[model samples]
Target: MSFPENKLTVRSSADLATAVPYLIGFHPADGSIVVIACRDRRIVFAARDDLPAPGTPAHHLRELTAHLIPVVQRQQPITDLMIVGYGTKEHIDPALRVIDDAFTATGLAVRELLRVTESRIFSLTCSNPACCPPQGTPVDPTTSLIAVHATVAGLVARPDRAAVASRFTSVDSTGDVIRHATTEATARKAALETAGSTAVFEAGVHAVRSALRQHDNDTPLTDDEVAWLTVLLTHRPVRDLAVDLTQPHDQHVTFWAEITRRADQALVPAPATVLALTAWRCGDGVLAVMAAERALQVDPNYPLAHLLLQALHAGLPPSAFEQATTSTHPNPSIPNPNTPSEQE
Candidate 1:
């Protein structure tokens, strides 16, 4: 995630420690490693992954290095990086060395290497006790200016990654209501199909527009409305229209997230993938990855979800979708329902 340059800066280890959570949208777990890439002193990309087990085999470390190197490499022109490992030195050093060696071998400078714990942060490269104390420098993000700036800039540092993931979790209380609505929606959709592809496409487009308006108005969609929209989203053209209409805004995130949660099990992939795309565009990689994983869990062969996962893994910026977004027609082409299809 990129931050507003004027709002935040990292001048010291303490500041860097305070900024990590805001960069990734959550506090790193005890065994997590966060890598931030910078170009001309501005953070351009940041990602977090679990540290390999202490006794993990060399091949396993190699695999971990392989997975991470490409992600950083994809952010071309990165002059340096800050690598923070969250755990005790014993737990973090092994994987930290492997990663440091890998990046150094690739000719990229490691600007800082630090090990962080709940109470303090230790600079691995500095031995001068006067500055980098043996006991470590104390860290309290709650009192940090960086934290204040991040919050003022509308960035949220969730307690942990699980807290971020929980936003997309299904609501149990709505299950019975949605299930009943789905039954009625299914019957209605069958009747629309009988009227031919044109009718189905028009109805689906209308559903998409209406649902978006309701969300924009801060009006909750009725269970039947949510069910009908979810069913129509299963149509490829209708799903594409939803994608075209999604903007890189927090309300878009809120809208698609609610739809994904309320959608029937078989109908989740479309809305979930749209949620993923919306989150990514909003520069919330943590949320994007979670939403994409949720979709793939429901439909392993989902094409758009897989595409999103690939782009994310490759560290492509959200601007990569700029052309497609700008060129999108307000109205999507009508699909021939009779066309034999692969997975939608």
Candidate 2:
């Protein structure tokens, strides 16, 4: 049953919680509740309240890039021409690169991208008891956003915002409307949406993992959600590459091809640990070398990429490659002027 807007139908929460295991990649933790989306629909739920802590940032990024991006790419698939507004500046750089690769694979005009922006905010709060305190000096940042939105936008953009609002459906619930930006409810949705608009959450761990246990699992679910679950869990468009990546699931090479096709070494970051993973996943030596060089471009001192390059050079996987790279770009202490580095 659907709950009407503006109220958290108490009855709905229970069913929603029970259904959440069917949405995103949360193994469930004690204190965290997340928005898990299966395809385009989302289920709101807290972790089992019994599991361990949620995943780390790097871990989350790996899982997301490996799982989420593929699914979204399958759908929207537009890159070179994107309009994204995300969390803050720091995540934007690597994030944009990932986005660039995702869309570019779709044959989108990634060489020349356009229009990417972000806002510096996640939460807001008030200093005094009154939600709208009299204008004065503000001590907190969120307080400042509230003041700005209240004093400036309230006066100037209210009418304009109304027109925009009219164009889109107003699905705002009381939870969404009254919730202050500082509240978890706010940070979890609209704020996160505005900040990380570049990457949207899809598929629930609780559900997909269950689905993977057997074929013809839940026949009743929408085909789109099921398709995404299949891809997210397996992660290999090709069975052989997945086997190479040590994923014992499916056989679909498209995943490897799409990921590897972007390996142009000239554009990747240094010390290609991430790139190495990408290459291994895709199993393309040419892309691997390109990625290795790309890493060196960021910092010639990348030990791992250097080692990998050395291994490839010798057609072996031992000290041979490492030794070669070291000799060529030896310790730059005393310095041999002939062997120019990036500075040269």
lDDT, candidate 1, 1-344, per-residue tens: 23544358777899888998888989898999999898877888888998777777788778877888888998988889889999878888777888999989988888888999887999888899998998999999889988998888778889997788778778567788898899899899999999897777788777887788789999999889999999988887788777766778889898999899888888889999889999999888889989999999999999778878888887888777545444643343743434422322
Count of backbone collisions in candidate 1 = 0
List TM-score per model, in order.
0.91, 0.19
- Estimate the TM-score for candidate 1: 0.91
Model 2, C-alpha of 140: deviation from truth (Å):
73
For model 2, the local distance difference test gives 0.32
Give one digit per residue, the lDDT tens place, for model 2 in 88-109: 3344445445545654565544
Q: Scored by CA lDDT, what does every candidate get? A: 0.84, 0.32
Give the least accurate 10-residue stretch of model 2, judged by summed lDDT: 43-52
